[model samples]
Target chain A: MMTLLFILFATSMWLGWHGKRKPAIFVFLVTIALCAFWFKHHATSELHIDL
Target chain B: MTPTFARKLNVIFLIMICIPLIGAYTIQFGRGEFPCPLCLLQRLAMLGIACGAMMNVRYGIRASHYGMCMISAVLGACISTRQILLHIVPEPGNTGYGSAVMGMHLYTWALLIFIATILILGVVFLFDSQFESKEATSKTRSVPALGAVAFWLAFGITVANVCTTFLECGFKQCPENPTSYLML
Candidate 1:
C-alpha cells in the first residue's frame, strides 16, 4: 500500500514533466484522496484529549 | 521576485526539502531503526509537498501548485501531530519513538518543517508576479537545467522509496513499529 502511494507520486511527476498538465493534476488529486485515506487509516487510535 | 528567480528558488526549495528525507534514510539504515507506519505517511506527505514545488518548476509558478504543496503540508502536519500526541506522555523512561535530535523526535521536527513550508509558501505567494500567463512565464523561465535537477532528485527519491518500502512491507501493511525490513 505504501509503495503504491509512492508510485502515484512518481507518475504524477512523470506526467507533469511530459507537459500533460491536466493529467498530472488529475493524478495529483487522486494522490491527495489516497493520502487522506491513509491518514485516516493510520490515525485510528483514539485520542484521549478532552474538549 | 522575478518569475525566473522564483523558479530558481523553487529549485532551491526542492533541494532543501530533500534534506530531511536523506536524514531519515541515513538513520533508518545507519541506526538500523525501521520506520513505523506513521513514519511512512509522514514521508509520503513530504513527497506530496515536494510535488507542488515540482509543478511550479515544470509548468511555471502557479498559485494552485503552491496550494497543492500547502495542502500536503497540512496533511503532514496532522500526521506528525498525531504521532507526537501518541507519544506525548510516554511511560517512564520511554522518552519517545526512534531517535531524538536536539531534544525532539523526527515527527516533532516534521511538524515544524510542515508549518514552515506553509508559511514560506504563503509569503512567496505575496509576490503575485509569477502568476502571469503560463506561456509567457514559461518562455521567460529559461533556466530549466537546475530546476530539472531538483525535480528529478525529489522524484528519484520517491522512486527509491517505492523500492525500499516494498522491501520493508511488501504488499502487506507496514508494521506499526517496524524493527527490520520485512522482505529482507
Candidate 2:
C-alpha cells in the first residue's frame, strides 16, 4: 500500500516537471487518497502485542 | 519581488530535501536497515514537499504551490508526532523502535524537519515578494536547468523508494517494526 503512495508521488513530480499542471494536480489528489486510507487504517487497527 | 529570487529559493529547498532523502537511502541500503511504515510515510511527505517546490521552480511562483508545500509538511509532522508519542513510555529503559541518529531518533528528526518546513513557509509568506505583479506580468519565466536536475533526482528517489517498499511489503501490510526485508 505504501509502495503505491511513492509511485503516485513520482508520477506527480514527473508530470509537474514536464509542465503538465492539471495532470500533476490530479496525481497529487490520488496520492492524497492513499494518505487518507492509510490514516484510517492506522487509526482503527489495534497494535499487535509481541508477547 | 523578483521571480528569479523566488525560483532560486525553491531550487534551494528542493536540494535541501534531496540531501536528507539521500541519507535515508544510504541508511536503508548501505546500512541494511529497513524503514518502518511510519518512516516510509514521512519519506512520502518529504517527497511531496519537493514536488511542490519543484513545481514552483519549474513554473512561476503561485500561492497554490506554497499551499501544497504547507499541506505536505503538516501531514508529515502529524505522522512523526504520532510515532513519537507512541514510544513515550513511563518506563525509563525504553529506547523505542529503530536506531537513533546523532542521539535523536530518525522520526524525531523528521518532526524537526516538518517544523522547519512550516517555519520556512511562514517566512516566505511574510515577504509576499514572489507573487507575480501586474507590471511584472510581461516577463517570461523559464525553468532553470538545475531545477530540472533536481526534479529528476526527486523522481528517481521516489521511484527507488517504490521499488524498495514493494520488496519489503509485497502488497501486504508493512511490519510495524520492520527489521529485515520480507523478500530477502
Candidate 3:
C-alpha cells in the first residue's frame, strides 16, 4: 500500500513538474480515492479491536 | 498572483509539511516508538499534503494544488480523530499506544496539523487577492533555488516514509497495535 502511495506521489510530482495541469489533478483525485480505500480497510478492523 | 505573495504561500506550504515530518521522525527514531496502522495512514496523508505543496513550488501556484492539500488534510483529520476516539475512554492501565508530547499524544498533534491545514487553505481561497493580474496567470513566477531545496526535502521524506512503511507492513496489512519495528 505504501508503495502504491509513493508511486502516486511520484507520478503526481512528475506530472506537475511538466505543467500538465489536468493529469496532475487526476493524480490528486486518485490519491484521495486510495486514501478512502485504505481508511475503510483499516478503520473497520480497528473498530473491532477497540470496541 | 503577485510573485511575492506566491513565494510566501510556497514557503508556508513547505513549512507546513516539514514540521510534522521532522516531529514524526524524531518520535519514531529518538523515542523508539513504532507507529501503528492508523499512525501510518496519518503519515501518508501528511506526505500527500507535501506532494501538493511540492507541486505548487515546482510548477506554479494553482488552486488545484491547494485542493490537494485540502483533500489530504481532511483524510488525515479523520484518521487522527478516529484514533483519538479509540482511546478516549481506555481500560485501566492501557495508557495509550505511543507516548505523549507536550501533554498531548502524537495523534492529537496530527489532528491539530490537519485542522490547521484546512483553515489555512480556507483563508487562502477566501482572499485569493494575490491573483490580480493576467501577467501573473500567463507567466507564473518560477520558484527560486530555495524552493528546489524544499522540493527535495519533501521528496526525501516521502521516500524515507515509503521505506519505513514497507519494513513495517510489507505487502500485508500493518498491525493496529505494533509492539516493535518489523524489519521484514
Best by DockQ: 1
lDDT of each: 0.85, 0.81, 0.76
Instruction: For model 2, report DockQ.
Output: 0.45
Which regions in candidate 3 have their CA more than 4 angstroms from the true location? A45-51, B1-3, B132-141
The interface root mean square deviation of candidate 1 comes to: 2.2
Q: How close is candidate 3 to the true structure, as a TM-score?
A: 0.87
Docking level for model 3: acceptable
TM-score of each: 0.94, 0.89, 0.87
Arranged by lDDT, best first: 1, 2, 3
DockQ of each two-chain model: 0.66, 0.45, 0.44
Candidate 2, which segments miss by more than 4 Å at Cα? A44-51, B90-93, B133-141
Best by lDDT: 1
The global Cα lDDT (0 to 1) of model 2 is: 0.81
lDDT of 1 by residue, B89-183 (tens): 77887567899978889999999999999899889988987675856534323447878788788988999999999999998998887877889
The residue ranges of model 1 lying beyond 4 angstroms of the native Cα positions read B135-143
| TM-score of chain B alone in model 3 | 0.89
DockQ of 3: 0.44
Worst 10 residues of 2 chain B by lDDT: B132-141
